[model samples]
Target: MKQTGVAILGAGRWGKHLVRNFLAHPDACLVAVVDPYPETLAAIKDKYNLAPEVRLATDWESIRDLPTIEAVVIATPAVTHYTIIKDALNQGKHVLAEKPLTLDVAECLELCHLAQENQRQLMVDHTYLFHPAVKRAQEVVHSGCLGDLRYGYAARTNLGPVRQDVDSLWDLAIHDIAIFNHCLGQLPVQVQANGRVWLQFQKEFQVSQLPVEKEFQVSQLPVESSEDNQGCSQSLTPQQPANLPYGNAKGEQPANLQPANLQPSTPQPSTPQGLADLVQLTLSYPTGFQAFIHLCWLNPDKQRRLGIVGTQGTLIFDEMVAQAPLTIQHGYFEQNGSTLSLLVNIVKFLISNHLNHFIQYAIAFLTVSACPNLHQYLLVWVGAQLVQILSCLSQSLHQGGVPVTVPQLPK
Candidate 1:
């Protein structure tokens, strides 16, 4: 097996998972690890039991001089992703970084263009996509078992893994968002979101007197009124907000709107519901296919589940517990008509074949040879989810819960 010398950046929570996975892969050789903090680097090194020759750097600069590093896996903050990945691509190294590409769209486009120009592969480490169930779901959808995909949806939620750098969408929903596209065979036409901002006004408000409604102002778009007393009303149209400045917009009021007043509305503010981290989206295609995605981080049961409903049949994927294989249902003849029955246990099938397929595709791409019949349509579908995520978030903030149109990918 040809070993690819790989370096891992960021030894935080997710970094450890990448390190362990890469170490297990026969085709990958873990060469260097980088992190700014001494403690984090030390913990990973001690845990992985690395040799003295395995370079550990407190800064990215130290490893730049190493000519042997063939690829870099960036597990750093969302803010630094573009710079690091751009530098790596510029140096002609392959990249397998985390999602959201960049916190904003411009950087993402720049990275995408750079990868194409350099002929270097830029695979986001959306590990859920590699799951057997997800692979099976994609297969059924593309293989015509599901017929024409009518709609698609997914849920990825958890109580406490929140980060201030990116919202629930970038942090958790990106996984399902990516997978939704993979299974549906289209990009989202529109995206909108509804979320709460705990610290919108920051220290300006007497936090004690503030009603939860005012505290949890929808992050979509601001409500505008001729008068403040008329009650701030905004439309939640479904259009994804692109290139959001990372949490830096705090304390600033929504455009054309004033800072929220702490006084409760008439009839008293409703009992403060827990934080709402839900993002719902829809997509439309010229071919008449539609996709809807609902992602909530508030679910007590942190399961990653998706359902693809179509004309002929449906494909359901459950990623709640590890090792639970994807179960498939296809149309079958009972006595006189059609009935649904299990076709395959997806988990076992994928665990046995997905990586091998990836390896074959990679080799084919490098050798300029005809590759095995695998589904690249999944990539086309994922692109749609990314667009819808931004569109829905934009609409949910301004419009009163309406679906927005997603921009079409350049043909």
Candidate 2:
């Protein structure tokens, strides 16, 4: 087997982790570590005890044209992703970028076109899509075990770790969104969101902020629009659901399921804050399934929860809940109107494999050596779907929670 030559750009908080992993992988030959901060590079080199053959550089230009560097793992800020990734893909080097591929949808589309043109791999670091629990949840959701799926909800909240570059919605929301899209096997046809702003644009801060998140807090999941999936409308061209971000290597779309209609909602003013300290969103799918999402950084009680209510039971994924990370609460007893007697047992799916999600992602990346088409796998498609969703949701959030339609991606 031939080794894939790789270069890791940015040796910061996340970049260092990539250095450690690539050093251990049997198929990856880490050729260089690039970052503007020299001290950070020195620390990683000393910490990892990198081989002498590895090169260190202050900028990508020094190594951009190097033939030995076949791939680049970028962990830089999102704002800088387009330039670096564009260069890498153009140079015929495969790329593995951090999440939210770019700040906008246009750039992602352009890069997707470039990757195809060059036949170079471009993947995102959406590790949650490869999570053991999420993988199981996807199988369960698509297997029809849940019976007529009713609706869904998820919350990704924590206390601190905010970033100024992007807002809480942009920073945190992609993870849970990726999970929902993966499990449900469909993209939200429309989304509606409203937020409250406090720390970012209050008496002390400026009001000229765009999509704010005080620190770097990324809310887990969302596809929320309208009230309980009402008020939004769409005339379906009757197309197959967009490809799941983590679908098969050939980029196959989901089963041919008839999608729902999307009605547009008037943009209405929700209580005006600055950048929302909290956000409430709803996602309406083609199958008429709706999902409500709660996002916030001010809440002290941290939570990572998502669930799908079905005719049989509710399948849940609560990351904070240690004992039973994934479970199903059967509503087997009896039901009266909306109320139900839940005198039933809960089914737990404890992930026994101790391998971390990133490790799993790395294994997938390495597999690209044998399977070139693997680039079209998981994060590549998932990242695009997420960026598109986030881009659409941003409009709804800024316009005071009007339902906005999510456009279909090119197949």
Candidate 3:
């Protein structure tokens, strides 16, 4: 097999995992690892025992133009995505960007157009969509095994590694939203959201109610540390993450890394002044299916769970469950059951364990390199669609939980 030469643009937590997977793949030749932090690159090099033939650099440009490098894997901040991806596509390098494609929908579409024009494959690493469990859930939901769709709910929360560049809505909600759209088979048309900013902004929760009365409450906890990508720095600093090329202590861009013609005159805010640690989202699909998502960075209860309730039963995808991460319970509803009781919920639930779907993601890029047309360009569209929903959700959340309509993708 002719190896596809690849370079990883960010070697942070998530990017390092990409590095590992790409290295393990027989068809991928990882030629370089790029990040602003030298220590991060050094750590990756030492950790992987990378060959001297592979390049390591602080700037992607230094290595991107290499003759051997045919593609770039981008796992940088949302703010930097537009500039870097635009550059990569313009240079005719196939790109595998991290989620949200870009913070803006227009940028995403532009990149999509650019990729098509350049005849290059542009994909986003929406890793959750690659999960075997999610794939199984998709089969169950699409096969009508779950019956008439009623509603869906997902909760993603963590104690720390909260990012300083973007909020939980930007960081955590994308995973669940991607899953929701995939299983539901359509993008959300409308969104109603509100958020609480505590760890980053320290603002009081501007409480709002969903149409239906909800009965739940969580005690807020606060922590101060800036870290993490698709999910960053060894020391979680402000905008100065270990993976991105953020300027200085004051958050200025280095002259070398400044956006050229490819960048927008005014880039979107890297960190919102009202950045929320917790966000409540209600996504309304065209089929009248609504999925509620709870996103939080201050909570210690590490949860990666999503459920779609149909007339027959619910399809549950819970990563925390070791035995069976994906399951479908047939016939009837069970309510008011404590979270712990779910472990012993009888023969009705908990599907078999899934393979490491994260590695499967690496194979996606290699496959794209081999056959761009057969490559599921839907992944790119899905990434863009998620960004569209997120853009609407951001507006609605900041407006005191008012409902916002998610935009339809332009033809």
Candidate 4:
């Protein structure tokens, strides 16, 4: 079996996962790893027990010219995707990049053009698309079981792992955005976003421990309207106020918020510039379908779930605690009818669906309990999906860049 030689461009948290998957894949050879941080490189090398033949470099240039490396997986920062992808494509290598493709549509288009010009496969790692739960949800949607998709709600939130490079939208919401596009079979025609900067620094940094500064903290800063509010309202046709503040619907600051005072000689802590810790987005699709995404880095509990409401019924893809991840509840209520009839139908729908769901849940739990390696099975399932994506990219490249289909917002 011929193997496609692949190099990884990052060795951070998610990057390391890619490295493991690539190493485990039989059709791919992990030829190199490129990261500027020595600790990361050392850790990956030690963890993988990388042989001397597998090159380890501090920069992409070292492996870009290597003939053995036919492809590159980019798990770097969003801001650097365009440049790295361009360089990799220029080197005649197929590229698989992490999501949000690029911060700008023009950059994404340019990368697509470069891939076409170079006859190399260019794909984004929209990992959720390959998840069993998301795939099942897509199946349910496309099967028309959830008749006439009306709207979707996706929530992806966590307490920490806050990043400085990108806001919550780009960091977390991008996953659901891709998932929404996948499930709906189309991208949004318009997007409206509202966000706030909550924790400017890491949680461990205490206000009392910090040298007092005269500058007001972000929490104490007065709320202001987002610059995009007016345009977003007009373009996206938002039902709610486009400029609403993060934690409050009324846009009022917390009552306990107070300004910080410090000495002139106090050392200032570095905070991310123009990055939001919480973001809410409304995406309107051409098919009259709407999607609401709520992203936060300050939540007490982690959540990864998506709910789709349709004319027929509602489907919830709760990735966190769900046994099957995809749960379908059948039947809908009629708004215009006799009050007694409406009440009877509602009661019947609830009783029938709840009883059916309980039976399914019980069976699912028993099956899972019977399988000792269920967790490992899930891991392999995910890995198989990744391998399938790689196979598609390699085949596409062999077919002279057949133009891999990607989700694109309607223009």
Query: How high is each candidate's TM-score?
Result: 0.68, 0.79, 0.79, 0.64
What are the candidates' C-alpha RMSDs? 11.3, 12.9, 9.4, 15.9
In the range 199-288, model 1's lDDT, one tens digit per residue, is 222222111121111112323334221110111111111121322111111123334433354212232111112223454555555566
Residues 1-411 of candidate 2: C-alpha lDDT, one tens digit per residue: 688889987775566667877888877788998866566678878999988889998778888888899888877656567778898888888888877687777788889889878887778877766667877788888888777899999997766443343455776677777778878878999998887665444222221233211122224422221111000011111231222111001111123321221111232245433445577889999999998888876566677899998887788898777656899776554878988677656889877542355655665564464334224444366677888998777778877788999999985
User: What digit string (tens of lDDT, one per residue) describes model 3 on residues 302-410?
Assistant: 7878899987768788877866887777775546655322222323344442224555554565455443332453447777878788878877877777778776798
Residue pairs with colliding backbones in model 4 are 212-262, 213-262, 214-262
lDDT of 4: 0.55
Off-target runs (Cα >4 Å) in candidate 3 are 202-228, 231-273, 333-358, 361-378
Q: What is the lDDT of residue 317 in candidate 4?
A: 75
lDDT of 4 by residue, 1-411 (tens): 577788888776566666776776666788998876566689889998988899988778767899988878776644456678888888887777665465555566567667657776666655565566665677778999767888999888765444433445545665676678677766555556655554443322121121111112233233333211111101101232322210011232233333331111222222223445666667777888988888776665677888998877777876655445667776766665655222221111111222233223222222232323222222212222322232232233223334343343222
